[model samples]
Target: MPETTIKGPVLVTGGTGFLGSHMVDALLEQGVAVRCLVRKTSNLRWLPEDKIELAYGEITDRASLDRAMVGIKSVVHSAAITMTEDHDEYYRVNETGTKDLVKAAMNHAPDLDRFLLVSSLTAAGPTSRDYARTEEDREEPTSLYGKSKLAGERALQKINPPFDWTIVRPGAIYGPRDPALMKLYGMVEKGSVVRVRGPSQLVSLIHVSDLVEGLIEALTNPIAVGKLYHQAHPEPITWDDVADYCAEALGKRTTKISVPRTLLPAVAKGAGLWASINRRQNPLAKDRLDDLLQ
Candidate 1:
């Protein structure tokens, strides 16, 4: 598709989310017309209703997706179930929902310029000792969430839709409104930092701002079509580094506490049990713990 044909509003899924909200703000800053596919029950505090259009819908509903795609020239698929108590919910929402969204685009958005899938580093799983993963990596998703995300990617690949498409796997994202890192900050403020007992675990991380910029580039840059890219900070860091930064930022002294890896399974199991009993998502559920350990 020609760049000129991509002039219509860009449709963003998950626009109400942490990362997606930043994506919408960035696109608005660039003077791009933006349309958000949001659930009627979604919180619209992050979205400026006067600036962008809202198409009330859920990703799993094909009819809603079709309605959202009307006059849409591009799509940024950022909506997904990241943390849920139900295992099958991951497959239903992340994998099957993604397939439904893609099919909607194929059926409705005839002039679609780009379809960008926002995935996670978990989709590629862990890398070998001292080695970083590349685009050619053999994905070995350790958790159901990771597996579901990989299945979503396959939805695009196996279907091979007519429209140009790109996939971007972003590393752990941290920025304002991110609750994931708030635990670390809280721990640091309490004069303690926690880590698992093991060899130094290296992980990729990117600020939400940088990740959003990369996603926008991948969606707009012609070279990104039919390509997969890993978006993360160039340097890898350990949990200690993150804690140290948090301590420094807070101007506080902190002590490091390392829990034995042997205790992880018990902790995860307990968390899972509690979640099941309460019918609520647990922060340290087994599957999420597996992803965290990696």
Candidate 2:
């Protein structure tokens, strides 16, 4: 497919999120006009206000999505809840919300050129260190979040929309302003890391800049239409690799300790119980504990 002229703004969902905010920056830096679909309650601290339009909306609402899709040339759906004890919420937001957005774009944006979905490697589960997961592999999602992401993909595929579309699944994205890695960086600054010596699975990592580049590529490249790509550094890394780099970056001597696997179940249960009592998310919920090992 030859590239069409970009005649309208690119609408981005979750523009205030860490990854979404980076996407916003990349779009603006490249001279594309951006319109963000944002809720009134969303934080704009990570988002820049200049040269951008804000369209108040929610993914689950058709009317709001309709307003956001007006004069939109393309859409980048990047919103999803990462932590939730209720499995239904994942399906509601990731899967159902995507269906609504795709429908709105199809119904509202007559000249839409691209519709890119920023999924995650968790949707494909994991592989041994010897074999990196590829787009050709059959998906075997091991977590609720992964299943919801896969569901989102399936929801769009079911529509069979008449437009250029692609999917990019990224792994463990880390960079400046990302809070997920900050805790580990803080621990490294204090001179220690907790290592779980168990199954020792392979994991992939990508920088925010590289992943944002991949996102733009998937939109502009004709070869990406109806295709799936896994974007990551060309290698798999282990926890030891992460620890050493963190320590090196912080210039601190760090102690690494091996923790017993038996200790996790109790911790997970205790955390789950406390969360249920307080209506808060457990950092060590069973799924999260499984995530730490798997």
Instruction: For residues 1-294, write the lDDT of model 2, one tens digit per residue.
Output: 646333358999989999999999988877889999999988899888877999998887789999899889989999887777777888899999999999998899999989999988889987666788789999998888888999999988899899878988999899988886898898888888887767555678999999998898787878889998899999888877887898988888999877778887886788889988998777776664565467
Q: Which candidate leads in lDDT? A: 1
Question: Model 1 misses residue 121 by how many Å?
Answer: 1.4
Q: Rate the local accuracy (lDDT) of all candidates.
A: 0.88, 0.85
Give per-residue CA lDDT, model 1, range 187-247, as digits (tens): 8889987789877577789999899888877877788889999989887788778888889
Clashes of 2: 0
The Cα error of candidate 2 at residue 94, in Å, is 1.1
Q: Give lDDT for model 2.
A: 0.85
The TM-score values for the models, in the order shown, are 0.93, 0.92
| Runs of candidate 2 exceeding 4 Å displacement | 1-7, 270-281
